[model samples]
Each structure stands twice: as structure tokens, then as C-alpha cells.
Target chain A: MDKWYVGVDIGGTTIKLGFVTEAGEIVTKWEIPTDTNNGGRNITIHIGQAIKSKCSELNESYDRLQAIGVGAPGFIEMKTGFIYQAVNIGWKDFALKDELEKETGLQVTVDNDANIAALGEMWKGAGDGAADLLCVTLGTGVGGGLVTNGQILHGVNGMAGEIGHLTSIPEGGAPCNCGKTGCLETIASATGIARLAKEAIDKNPQTTLANKAEVTSKEVFEAAAEGDEVALEVVDEVCFHLGLALANIANTVNPAKIVIGGGVSKAGDHLLNPLAREFNRFALGRVASGAEFKIASLGNDAGIIGGAWLAKQG
Target chain B: MDKWYVGVDIGGTTIKLGFVTEAGEIVTKWEIPTDTNNGGRNITIHIGQAIKSKCSELNESYDRLQAIGVGAPGFIEMKTGFIYQAVNIGWKDFALKDELEKETGLQVTVDNDANIAALGEMWKGAGDGAADLLCVTLGTGVGGGLVTNGQILHGVNGMAGEIGHLTSIPEGGAPCNCGKTGCLETIASATGIARLAKEAIDKNPQTTLANKAEVTSKEVFEAAAEGDEVALEVVDEVCFHLGLALANIANTVNPAKIVIGGGVSKAGDHLLNPLAREFNRFALGRVASGAEFKIASLGNDAGIIGGAWLAKQG
Candidate 1:
């Protein structure tokens, strides 16, 4: 259908709204500040206004809109259309989907933001046409989605692909938000990489990256590109951890392709090469050979595209 | 659809055959010797004579047979109907489908024995009706299978589920056939448990189980039940590794149910209780609250049932 669909990518501060077509082309998009206070009513109204404003701006009737898809950042109940738990949003059991659907008067589909983003990429990004896929999003937190046999594996509950919280280091690790230690999220996420950079800065004062003011993982990559040995070591170590996680998953499921998304995957071949090498060392034979991982192609559009696909599922 | 079908569980020695229904019910099962050396042609002859004799004994005609489903132990290509690398079977890229079909004049379906056994369980056993499932056979090796939305999750090459080779302890523990160290199979399989028992017996010569003439996993379980300290330690150790592996899989996939089968699972709740407790300790909070696990239900009938189902997938 040529009718437009609304996709909302909910984040801590800005909520990205996109009117995308079934062909995965974004027609128009905008962002609005998320207001969580006063029972999330204002946020619901904002969503409706944004949909109405976009349709009106294009001289199109609201009925011309096909559906609304919300990529809620954390735990979500697709059955009830509620945002169950989002630490960033501070909303528990928030009827975000139901309220949005009621106000917008459109079919609304809501799921974990990362799962939708992974689906987005699978639809038209790096992992297109792959029936078996595992998508890892290395953002503030490591969120993952596993698609098998053309459908997302949502486990018993909605929390099927919680690979970040997997206990990699059984005993010692950095404390995580989920009250766990030594999770993939604690080491491989952009936030985790920054934490590592911060630790290295404290330990090695002679390092070039250590001399930089307010160091970030991006700065670490840049410094590493310029031959900073410490930065290189940090990257290698981080990739080793990521590789172990991928190998563990590979041995179990043997997905056809692993789509790496989020800001960090933009590190490109630098990350991809090491990830492939280390995964080769760890993954079981045939499982490692069967699945080839690639950098997610959709980049920022993965959320919008995957959200549309999720709506199509409904 | 139950005119008659041959369900052969091809092992290293015995070939167990049964007449199975489309509904997965096994009837008039019999066994015959597996002769892989007389050039694959002899296998069909043996299977034919055994089935004919069985049919004559039951006053049924050979013409009443419908199809044949073979469960061969090793890596198999279900789609191509070939056996790739079952070193024990002495078949490398053998066209089992064509050979069996040509000989028997009936359609044939073949797959890795463990995978078919899991399909059997998924179809009619403990995992019946579950949308997503992980089946682990804890025998000499920790063979596994993944079923998502009621279908097997075979990767590009049909080598989808190989969980045994997953390195549970990253650094070092025990050696694996795939040249890995500290794999889940090394610590938790039936062979692993027997090794642990032997090591304990060697170290603690005065212990109750140590004094036994021959130490098997069954003997170890028996000792543990009689409150032998050494037996208890070995059992606990095996279950500990199993718990880690299970939790790792659960955290990654979060399947609806996990079915434990093979020789080791016969220990039942003695092993399952400790395994579940340890899995809870290592699993993500959301997963610990969800994901049901139980012992496999079909027992020996799993092969015939799974084969019948795979044959139906034709």
C-alpha cells in the first residue's frame, strides 16, 4: 500500500517520528521531546498531534495513514500495547500503545525498540532476505533480537533476546543496571566502551587518548586509527568479548547472518574484522562457517523500517 | 495416512524400525543390524527383509508401506536428504534419500538422529504445542536442536544446533572433539560425568563409590542416592556446568521450553533440580521468571516419532 505509516523511536530525550512507506523509503520525519510526567498523557497527545500535523502538511487525510508503530526503548507488552519497563523513560506499565492508538485512531503496534530496529534492518538493511538472523544493537545498552525462520523468536515472555545480560564472566564484572555483573552490556556497549576507556585513562597516563579531555569511545576509535597502542588494545579486548558472545550464540542457534547495528558498528571493518576473527576462534565448526555477520546497512533508518515490518506482522 | 511407514533409528550398531502414524504413534517396531560396509545397497536389503518379515508376521503386505524416515546419527542435510559427516556411519556426502528411495520404491526422509529425536519430542512429547524449544541430548556429547514456531531452526547447511561445542569456561577446563577447551560437553555430558567419577575414585580411594569395580554414570547416581560424598560432588559439578550452559542458551534464546534427554537426563530431578537451581542463578531475571524445562517424554519412541514428522515435512 502507498499509504503512510508512523514510526516512533522512543529514546531518553528525543522521540524520532518518521512517515515511511512499505518500500522502506522515509518520506518525512521529525523529533519531539518526550514528556513522561502527568501520567504520559502529554506524550500520547504529542504522538497524535505529530501524526495529524504530518498528514495535514502533505494535504492528506488522516484516514490515508495505514498504521502507527512505536519502538518503545525497553520492556514492552505487545499483547496489551503497554510499555512495561523503561528505565530511561521511568514509565512502568504505561499504556503508551493503547493511549497512542486511542488518540491517533489508528492501528498501533509496539514492541521492544531494539527488536523493531533489528527487524527494520532485516527488512531492507544489511540482513535482507535472511530467514535466520541475530541482530545486536550496541547502544547505551546492548539490546538484541533473534529472527529465525522469518519470524522474530520472542521466547516465552517478550524478553527472548536478552543477550546483553548473559553472564559472560561468571563471577567478576562491572555492575550493570539490571543488578548483574560481567554482562555483554557491561563491556561491549558504547557506554561500556567508554567505561573501558575511562579505566584505561586512569591506568595509563602516558597514552595519547589518556591526555585527551573528556574521552569518549569515538575518541578511542579515532586515537586507535592514529596508532594509539592502548586504544588498539582496548578495541581488541572489547571485540574479544563481543566475539565470545557471538560464538556462544552461534553455537546454539547457527543463524544465517548476524546484523550488527547501533553507533558502534559504524566503526566498520575495524570492528567487523576483529569480530569475525575472534568469533572464528571461539565458535564451533560449521556453526561459525554457516553464519557470516555483516555491518547493518539501514543505519538510522533500521528503527523506522523495522517498525513498519512489525506493523505488517500485526 | 497410517497405511504403513518405516521409522528407522540408525545407530552405530542396531537399527530400530517402527511403523509410525502421521499423528506420531509408533506400532509394530522391530530392530535389525546396520551394515554400512556392503555398499549402502545392502542397508536397503536388510531393512526390506526385516520389514517384510514383520509385515508377514502381522499378515500385512509389503505393498501397504507408504514411506521411510531414517534417523542417522551425525550431521545430515534434511532438505537434500544426505548424510554429510557421521564418521561412525562411514558416509560422507552420501545420497541416502536417492539410495533408500531407489531401493525401497518409497519416498524417504533422513536427518541427524539427535535433531530428529528432538523433532519427535517437539511433535508429541514434553515440548508438544510449544512454539519455541531447545532440546539437549546429554549422552557422550551434548547434541542439541532448536525449534521455532513449530519448525526446526536449520541454518543454511542444516547444521543449525550444535550446542555441545560451546565453550562454557572461556579460559580452560576440558578438551572437546572440535579442538576447543572447557566446552559444556566436556563438563556435563555422560562421558564427562563418568570421567569425573573416575577422577574422584582415583583421588578418594576410601570412598564408597571409589571401591566399586566399575564406575559408570548410573553407578555414580546410585552412589549419590546412597549419600556418598564423592558421588554428590561429581553430580553437583556436572549439574553446575549444565546449569551454566542452559542459562547461557536461555539468556540468548529464551525458548518456551527446554527438553533434556539422552542417558544422563535419566538421573531425573536429582540432576534437574540442581541444574534448574544453578540456571536460575545464572539466567537473566526475566528469563528466570519464565521458560519451563522438563525431561524428554518420548524416550526410545522419539526417533520413530521424529522421523515420521520429518517424513511428513516432505
Candidate 2:
């Protein structure tokens, strides 16, 4: 009899589910549209029903599911598995673990979504089983997950890997959404990259980017790849801060791997090459020798896979 | 019938020893001059003979000794207990653990001096037994040790807590001994404070600090306490860099406590008050709320006490 685990990744738009085997195999995976009406009350019920349907389709008994692990985007109480706040999902002070457990009659575990993504990479993706790794996601806002000794460092308040908020310029830089000025997120996120391109184009009327009404992160990378001076400068500034931030973390944690993910990372070697060069310039020589950089491989499936890792750990 | 652990803190000029009971009691302690002649070959023998003599003085046989733990100021190989380098002691690639074990006929463990100091503080000093803490030593240079889940974070290559090497200014900052420029140590260390004071006084000849023959970190703090303009500016600058460095680390690790140690910490509230203010200003509000700042209480005994902790763990 093969035991199974249900890994769920709850997002604002949709919920991803995975029926994972003990050996880290995903026998089946699917998604359901998130029902956020009425404070997300129907979210857990939808997930429960989806899990049952998946088990039936696979011709496996639901009893084969030993546990359910969930990855939710918010501050989570480690002991109670409560979602302190998930602004995207309209959840606050919700006992998500208890709700899912009651609805499905199964034990449940929950953790922050970013942390689970890092664990997913470590378990079956780019980390390649490295126990110490740092996973950085560069989307609308930068997010980070630090794994030490094969476990997530949740810190005292689940704010351990808030690398996005690190003060890069330290003086008179851009303002941040967190009510702080000169935060790394102000310059290195996807939104930050587009903002930088727009600012540069606005200052100089000759830039090719000026022809477009609005610039996106993808357009910025593309313009840089095509040797647009404005876009190149933006990429350089972004990589400079990203490198400094990564070096700071490397000096602190000496992680074996630094994995970059999310939309900005789609720039690929254009982002990684300069970032690695900058990282080498800032990182202590010994720490640099032990660490290597890689692009994240698990894309959207990272959350569910990381949830599986949590289930296995629980 | 009581068993005891022998803790040794090896320094360039002297060695500190402690005979500790299993219950974390230091029954007796002593110091011995270190003989670095002949490549420091006789230092371990002296430690072994001293431990034996101490046991005889207390009317107890060496058979009562459970294990020996050593705190050496160098990069140590955790598994083999090798001292990769101790420039002060002229030791390189030395099998310190094997030598001590062979000489004393007991199991032995070795760790970095700063790490042992942090362990000492956590076990019996200001950490108050908190499992997650970051201890920073501000001396000739800055040294840091991070304890998480009640154990040291050794990282992949034993360089996890190299916080001093983090690029603080990230641009044109002071040069460090590690062949890097603008590191946190170049601005936040005791030496850095003295240097900053000298530079500031040189630039403004009318300041009170300009009259001093030599500006030390202590003099700068004293002048700041008395409201000296140049000294106050220097203090602010040092605290600014120190606070930013700490906040960056706090954002990364979110340790429950940040413990300051070493000589510069003697300035007390003069350094801490400003540092706490800057740290809170930069730290994520949630992390700042959960983390507290404290001065290390163990002083010089921290090394030997931490060594005893390692012995107990072993």
C-alpha cells in the first residue's frame, strides 16, 4: 500500500493541488479557481472537494492520503497554522489548517508560500538537494526564502527572509511601499525595473523606450538585449543592487546556492551574468567560492511541490 | 561521583580554563600564559597538564573528566576539529582536536572563538536561553555568530556569520584588512570608529577632537556623551552604519535577540541607544517588534563557558 500526501497551494486567483507520493513524485496535479467571496469561506471546501475528485480519478482510496500540506501567502502562525493576514486572499485571523482538516477529515500543515517555494526547489528542482540555499522571487514585489540545514528559517515572527526590504542605497533612494525609503524592492523588483526604464526614458526624449506609452519589465530586458542605452543603464542599476543584496545575504548565511525566480528572472543570463559578477565583487572570497547561482526551474508548480515537502516534513 | 567537563579558551597571549559540572556550574577557573614558541606546539600540552593539576588540587582524579571542549580563534574544520589558520598562534592546518585528545586521553571538540562566545552568552548570559540569537563582537575587527534552533549555523563552509564583511557603503568606503573596501567592519568596528574620528577631526580643525594626540573609540564615545560636535558626528556615522548592518541581518534572520559584545560595547547606552533607533528605523516593523537588543554579560569568560557548552553537547 503506497501512502500519499495532498499538497495545496492557495493563491488569490486559483488553488493548485498535487497528489504526491512518498518518493517525491507527483502522481497527479491540477488547479481550481479560488472562491474569495464571503471572506474566502468557500476556498477550503473547494480544495477538499477537488482533492476527493482527484483521488477518485486516480482510482486511489482517499485513505491513502496520510496528510495535507498547504502553502498560503501570508504571515502564518507556525504552531496553529493560522493565516494572520493574506491580503490577496482576504484572509485574516483564519484557522486555515483547522478548516481544511475539518472539511476533509485529514491532518493539515501550513506555511508561508514563499518558504514552501524554496523548499520545492530544494526537494525536486534547481537546488538539487542542497540543504542551504536562498530563493529570491522578483515579481511585483521582491520576496525571499532562506533554507538552512534543510529547513525554512521562519525567524521569531515569520519575517526571516525579507531581503526585499534591505536598504541598498542607504541614503536618498526611491520610496518603498513599506513606508521606507531606499529599499531594495524600490529598484530591483519587476515593477521597479519598469519604473526605472520609464524614469530614464522620461528624462531623455531620445530613448527608443520613449516611443512606447508604457514599459514593462520584459520590454526593459528586451531593449537592453537590443543595446538601448536607457535600458542598459536600468539593467545595470538593477543588477548592482541585486548583487549587493545577494552578497549581503551570502556573507550572513553562506548558502550553497542562490536561486533566482519570478518574472524578472526571465531575463535569464542578461540578469544572472551581471548579478553574479556583482555578487562576486561584494561577497567575501571564501563565501563566493562555496556558492553558485542558478535560475529557478519549477515555475508555477513550486508552491505545490513545496507544500508536499512540508507535508513530508510534518 | 560528579562528572566534569574541561573547557579551554585559547588566545594568542593566554589560555583560559574552566572545570564545569554537568549542571552548567563552573567549579573553578584559571588562566595560563601561552607559549607560542616552536610553532605553538606546547600550548595544548600545557592545557592538558593544567587540567590534570587542577583536578589533583580539587582531590579528584582525571577519570572524572567527561570531555574537553576548546575554543580557538581561527577558522576551524568542524568535523575533524582542525585549525585551518590561527595567525596569532602560528598554527595552520593543525589537527587541534586529535592533539588534545591524544594528550588528555579524552574526547575533544573545537569551534571558532566568537561562536563559543555566543554559545556562552546564550546558555548562561544575556540571551536567557533563547534558541535564536545573533551575537556581534566589536573589537579590533567585527565578528558575528548566529545561533538558530539552539545550534550554531555553520553554513556550507563554516562562513555563515561573516557579517563584518558585508558591504555597508557598497561604493567608495574605507578599505578593510580582508582586501575589500567599504565593508561593515571598515566603518562599524572599534578601529573604524577611531579612524572615522581622526578623519573628521582632520577635515574640521576647529573641533574639540582635533586637539587630541590620538583619537580612540573610547575618546569618541566620551566626547559624544559630552556633546562634542565632531565626536558626536563620528558617533552618529558609526552608529548609522552599525544600525543598517544590524537591520539588514535582522531582516534576513529575524533572531529573537541581537547581543553586542567585545570592547566597544563598554560604551554602553552611548552606542546602544543610537544603534537601536537606527535599527528600528530600517528594520521591518514586525521583525523589530519581536527582536530585542542586549549587551553580552559573559565578558572574557564567554569563550570558556561556550567551550564547556560544546563539551556538554558532545
Candidate 3:
């Protein structure tokens, strides 16, 4: 009989759930709109019911369902699966693993969403089985997950892999949501890119980006691809810092692969080429020689897959 | 009967050796001049003879010796103990562990000198049993070793802990021995400090250091202690880069303890206070909250002690 694991990814708007085979195949996946009307108190109950109904629809015995792995946003207690606070999901001091286990009658494991995404990449995506890997997502905010010796480094306070918060400018730079000035998040994130594009447009009204009422990171990359000098300059500045930060990270951990994911990464080689040039110029020669960069392939499914990995490990 | 392990720390000028118990206590320690005249070919033989002679003198049989651990300065193949190069000792392509085990009828383990020192600290010095650690040594050159999940992270190419080579200046910085520019070693190292002092003196010849025939890092620290304006500025600059690099590293690894070691570390609180200030300014809040910094307590004995730790683990 084939055993199955339930992988759940909890987000602000919706909950993504998948039944994954022991071999990392997604047997079936679906989504449910997040019911956040009551501080997300009914989340576990909804997930439990969803799993039972899905099993019945597939006409599979409950014995085939093994364990559950969840990826939730915000601060998490890895051992206890306690949610210190997930601002997006309106969860505070919630015992996610305990509640889920009680409702579903199975064991559960929980980890940060970003970490699980990295684990997913490591298991069945871009990580390619490299034990030491660094996965950075260039989304609204830059998120990072570091894997060393095939285990996620949660740090002492679960703050490890906070690569986006690295102080890149180091002096008199933009303020970050983390209350720090000049963090890499202020430069390399999608929001940061758009902000930089706005600043560039403000400085030079003759550029192609000046014509667009609202400049997005995608528009900036597209303009740069079309040889717009202003957009190219902005892209250069963004990649320079991104490359330097990634190189420094590679120097410290000497990862075998650096997987770049998220919306801004959709820039493809336009981002990676310049970023690699800067990374080569900044990283220790040997470290640069050892690391290979790849675009993340899993996309939205990374979280559920990584959750399955966590459940499989458990 | 208590078994004993032999720990060897091979340096350019001398080789420090020790007999340590499984509990990490050094029973006895000694040193010998390194025989680098013949490309370090006789090094293992000499160590083998030293162990045999010591056993005879102490009236202990060879059967009581358990294993040996060696700390060598070089690019090593960790699993095979093959030294690809050790420029200081003129050794290349040497099978250190195999030769040592053949000469002395015992098992052997080998690691980089900096890594062994970190292990020594983690075992009996200031690491306090914290599983994840980052140990940085500031000497003629900066050296680093990273521990993740209680195991040394020997990245894909054994360059994981090359923190000193992290590009700090990124542009128009001094060149390093590793053929890079603006590496952390070019600013925070003992040699770099003296060079910075010389540059400061050239610009402002009215400083107290202008009176000295030759200025050293020690003199710079002393002058700063005595309120020399130029010296204080240099200290601040060095601390700024050091703190920024450490903060960035902490953000990546989220180490529990950061152990600062080596000769330049002798500057003590004079160096730590300002470094801590910059560290707090740059590090992510939770990361800074989780990490505790400590001066390396083992001094020169860290290598041999770390070697003993390796042998004990083996």
C-alpha cells in the first residue's frame, strides 16, 4: 500500500493543501479560502476536515494517510510547532501542530514558509540534491532559507537565513520594515526595485520609465532589455548589491547551489547575467568556482512539496 | 585503564603536540621545530618517533594510545586527509592521515588549523556547548571556521568559512593575498591596521603616531586608548567593517555564539565595545538578540585541544 503525506501552506488569502506520495509526487492538490474572521482559530479544523473529505473522495482508507507537514508565515517554534505570531494569518501563540494533530488524529510538523520552500527545492526542485544550499526569493520582500548538511539552519531563535536583512548600504540608506536602515531588502526586493525605478524616473524625466505612470520591477526589466539607459542603470545598481550580498553569503557558507526564486526572478538571464558577473567579482575565487546558480522551478508548489519533505523526514 | 589521544598542531615554525584525555583535559603538551627543509617529507615520521619516545619515557605501552588528530595549515581533502598544499610548510599532495596512521599503529583524523581551533573552543573554551558557532581569528591574516548543527561546515570545496575573504570595500580597496580587493583581512587584520595607521599618518602627520619610527597595530590601539584622534578613527573604521561582516554572517547562519580569537583580539574590550555597537546597528533584531560574543579563552593551545576533540569524536 502507498503511504501518503498531507502538505499544507497557509497564506494570508488562501490555504494550499496537497496529498503527496512518499516519493514526492503530488497525488492531488487543492486550495481553500482562508477564514480569518476569528483570529484564524478555525484553521486547523478546516484543514482536518479537508484532509478527511479528500481521503473519502479518493476512496482511500485512513491508514494510507500518514502525517502532516505545514508551512506557515511568521515566527514559529520548530520543536513545539507553536506560532509566536503570523501577522498575515492573524495567528498569535497558536499551537498549530498540537491542534492539527488533535483534529486529524495524526502527527504534525511545522516550519516557516520560506524554509519549507527551500526544502521543497532541495527535495524535488532546483536544489538538485545539494546538501548545502541557499535559496533566496525576490518577492515583495526578500526571503531566505539556508540548508547546511541537508538540514535547515533554524538558528537559536529561528532567525537564521534572514539574508534580506543584511546591511548592504551600511550607511545612510533607506529604512526597512525591520527597523533597520540600508538592509538588502531595501534594494533587491520587488518593492525595492520599483522604488528604485521611481527614484530613477524622478531624476531623469526623459527615460522610457518616465512615460509609465506607475513603474513596476517588470517594466524596469523590460525597458532595460530594450536598451533603455536609465533602466539599465537601475538594473545594474540592483544586481551589484544583489551580487555582492550573494557572493558574501557564498563565501561564508560555500553553498553548492544558489536557487533564486520569486516574482523578480522572472527577469531570467537579464537579472542572472549581471548578478553573476558581480558575484564573480565579489566572491572568493574558490567559492565562486564551486557555486552554480539556478532559477527556482517549483514556484507556488514549493511550499507544499517542502511541507511533504518535512513530513517525510519526521 | 584510561586511553590517551595524540593531538598535533603543525605550524610553520613549530609543531605543538599534546596528550589529551577523552574528557578534553590536556595531560601533557610539548612542541618541536618543524622540519620544512625537505618539503615537510619527514614531518609525519618525526611525529611518529616523538610519540614512541614519549610513551617509553612515561612507561606507557603503545596499546594505551587510542588515536591521533592533526591540525595542518593547507587545502586538505577532509575525508582522505590529503594535503593539496600547505605553503608555509612546503607540503603538497601529502597523505597526512595515512602516513601518520602507518607510522603509528593508530587511527588518525585531520582538519584545517582554524577549524580545529574552533572545535577546541566549542569543546573546552568559550563556545559553551552551543551547537552553531562562528569563530574568527584576527592575526597576521584573518582566519575563520563555521560550525552548523555541531559539525564543521566543509562546503562543497572546503571554503565555507572564508569570512576573511568577504569583499568589504567592493571597489578601490586594497588587494589581498587571495588576489581579491577589499577583503575583510585588508582592514581588520593586524597588518592591515598598521598599514591603515601609516596611511592616516601620511594624511595627518600631526598625530602622536608620527613620532614613532615604525607604527604597529598595538601602538595604534594604545594611541587610541590614550585619545589619539587619528588612532581612534582607524579603530572605528576597522570596527565598522568587522562589525558589518559579522552581522551579515550572523544574519546568514544565526550562530548562537560568535567566538573572536587570535592576536589582534588582544585589543580586548577596546575592540569589542565599538564592534558590538556596529553589530547591533546592522544585525537583524532577533539575530542580534540570539547571539552572544566571547573572547577565545584557549590562546595558543586551541589547536592541539581541538585536535584532541577530533580524535575523541573519531
TM-score of every candidate: 0.89, 0.97, 0.97
Local distance difference test, candidate 1 = 0.82
Model 2 CAPRI quality: high
DockQ order, best first, reads 3, 2, 1
Give the C-alpha miss distance for residue B282 in model 2, angstroms: 0.8
User: Mind giving the per-residue lDDT tens digits that candidate 1 earns over A1-314?
Assistant: 37777777887787888887877778888888988776555787887988899888988877777887778876777677777678777787789877887898888988777788778877888887787889998877888888877777777778778888877777778998889788889989999999999888788878898777787778888888888988988898889889988898888888888988787888888788878988988897778887888989877677777777777666
Q: Considering summed lDDT, which 10 consecutive residues are worst modelled in model 2 chain A?
A: A205-214
True contacts kept of each: 0.66, 0.79, 0.85
Encode model 3's per-residue lDDT on A122-191: one tens digit a residue: 9899998889899999999999999888999888889999999998898899999999999999999999
In order, the first chain's TM-score in every candidate is 0.91, 0.97, 0.98
Per-residue CA lDDT of candidate 2, range B129-242, in tens?
888899999998999999987888888899999999999887788889988899999888899999898899879888878778888898899989999988899989988989
> In candidate 3, residue B267 scores what lDDT?
88
Top-scoring candidate (lDDT): 3
Q: What is candidate 1's lDDT per residue for B1-314, written digit by digit as tens? A: 34666788888787888987666778778777778784444776777678778888988877777888788876777777877766776677788788878777778988888887888888889997676788999998888988876788786667677888887777767788879888888878888888889999889987798677888788888889888999999988887778877888888877788999989889888888878988887888878777787899889888988887777766
Candidate 2 clashing pairs, residues 3+ apart or interchain: none
RMSD of each: 3.2, 1.7, 1.5
TM-score of the A chain in candidate 2: the value is: 0.97
Cα lDDT, model 1, residue A230: 87
